[model samples]
Target: MTDIAPPSPSSSAEPAHDRQNLIARQPILDDKRAVFGYELFDRSTAAAAHTAASDAALLFNALSYAGSEALVGRKTVFINCTHESLKGPHLELIHPERVVLKVQTLGEQATPEQIGELLPVFESLRARGFRLAFNQEVLRRAYASWLPQAAYIKLDLLAFKPELAEPLIKFARSYSAAALVAEKVETAEQYERMAALGVRLFQGYWFAQPTVIQAQTIRPSQATIVQLINMVRQQASLTEIEELLKKDPTLSFNLLRFINSSGFGLSCEITSFRHAVMILGLKKLFRWAALLLTTSRNTGSPPAVGQTAVVRGRLMELLAAELLQPEDCDNAFVAGVFSLLDVMLGVSLEQAFESVALPQPVVDAVLHGKGVLAPFLELTRACESADEEAFARCAQALHLSNRQVNWAHLQALAWAENLDQDE
Candidate 1:
């Protein structure tokens, strides 16, 4: 995970890992958030607690802030680039959305020829599906040449990199690259400088750091668990799931939106909740709903913890379905979910899985990847969580293709998002 665009790794050994943390402020312009994107900024595959590895992870662990209700569908996220990810897989994760990359970070010192070599890489990545951004202090040679290809450019206005700001800003306007971002702006004066320079995207505490809201722990209340168990037991019919969902107006609304999202690629629109329930089946529906319920905060809880679990669980579960044998799909869901148990509830795995009624093997996989479903499930989970070590390890163990894993994940997200949407 050493910073690649369209992030795809060839080796299973190095672990698909990037440990970056970020504190971003959605630069509000015209009372609207500037197009803030998830910028990938750090790396480490350590599972001992993401924050334990580096301050960057701690800072950026909540990069998913864009995923929460606090910023959902509002700001874009720009993840940093990695070498392996330079030409291919990194772009898709943030497609039809905003993402930023440090193009030169793909190399340290570039010869003119090397810069030329990367031009196609940038071209191909953008074509694959990323709305790209550039972050650099020196916008010379290659970057200057590629500036035309960028969607946005970020200059460190606070540090005032004379070498970078002038040329990048000039070229950005000349090409109509979406907007310029003035990062690290501290004082009112700094913001004013960049703002005057036409750098509308500003990131710094002077504006605001994406605040960390303490997330509420949504225990699968006994009532919720009983309902889930009943749903899976097939006692809850298609009509019943639909009705039960309406009881939670928010869930009903999201499910409908998901059913129609581009992720599903549905030729015919999904118009009814009952129809969606029938298509998904009881097992998957309950697993998904219960998981979603568990992730929703009840009070003054940070949305990140829960939202990440929801996205990660849904992502891994869907991918694992394609890779695992029929018998292990639910096990896959459990594995994907528990992978982040430590982070969300801030507890040991043993404590987290203890409350849920899962098969021993599934529990084993979630806890230590100790069962047959563990590797594949963990592999899918790793990619979704962007945990390169787990993904690389699990992928190598299964001798699976990175391409296959990504395709599976994309299909899964698209599927879940659509299936959950009623409208």
Candidate 2:
């Protein structure tokens, strides 16, 4: 759960409008078990029927609130759409090649005529370069009009008996040219079975689950990343780090934003990469780089995980500012941001820490849950989650009032939102 700021006493107790958008994504993997794209949906309205309004809201939020890069990055995005939404103006906002629109049926028993009526709509979308995806229902003879337009066909493993999947797979392969995607695949057996049946794409919890690291290891790849890690590992000179930052525009931009972020508690803005490096010094810059890479990496985690970490880091820093020294506040921010490193890196925190050398205080709070900053970290998490009891306990432990915490929480949310907008 991302730590969302609570409303202030002067404001309405109702949640913010954007908070209600609550977007969630599931990774779609290829045969090599690498993430190929994502299936994004509105978690806030998961139980609601698929309607024009719901479809519009999901697309609008994904584009506006979540931002494209933060949501799916460079990966293909699969969005569910109602027949009505298929003709919506919202679909115009997306780049056709990057998005695959999953068309939903009218109901459990939609007629052949009803499905055929949307053929023109489907054709129009394809003409505009948008790819279409359909459920296993499209394999039925009744949905023949819809089959030819399908670029991908999804098979929900849990929707039918195990033996039934193979025949459906065979039937789809024999008749249609669409790529088969096995959905709701929950175990190694399910994934293997789907692969053996010639299914190349998969979506489910089995591959999405974070890897449990039983031993310490470093798996840095890419020349730039390896160089950066090596530089940090060797405690290279400031000049060397600055030269490297100058070579990579993306890293330079991230560095400037990171040091000047509201949570960093800087009195003035940092305008240059060199200035930021000198001000933050070598150690803090390494921490910032670790965070930037962890969140920005294409590690198959949703953009929300990185976004949530930024919020937590800012929230904790703001909360710490009220009671701790400036240095401790800085550490608090790192602790908050790095708390989710395990999930973002697809490894345990123990293994994540083994790869990067973070401050001992941040490590203690995140890894062992024993340190001066541990209670504040707990309080920050409480603000993001719905555990009211834990919230009160942690807040009381820190001797802070609800108003103070709420104010910080709200500020952190706004800060993170602003950062996304800048991006």
Best by TM-score: 2
Predicted candidate 1, C-alpha RMSD: 19.1
lDDT of 1: 0.49
Which segments of candidate 1 are over 4 A away from where they belong?
1-74, 88-94, 98-102, 105-108, 161-168, 175-178, 210-423
Instruction: State how far residue 38 of model 2 sits from its true place (Å).
Output: 0.5
* Cα RMSD, model 2: 17.2
Whole-model lDDT per candidate: 0.49, 0.68
Model 1, span 288-349: residue lDDT tens: 44333333333332245444444455556556665677446544554554566567546576
Models 1 onward score TM values of 0.42, 0.47
Candidate 2 lDDT (Cα, 0 to 1):
0.68
lDDT (Cα, tens digit) per residue for candidate 2, span 1-423: 122121122111112222344677888999998889988876655455556656665654454334344456568889888777788654544458878999865665887677778989989999999999999878878787777899999999898888897899988987888999999999899888889988999998887842221211112222454456567667778778765653333344345444443224356655544577788765555444443333232323125766687788888988899889987886787788778877765768885554443568888999999898899899988998999999999999999999999999999888776643332
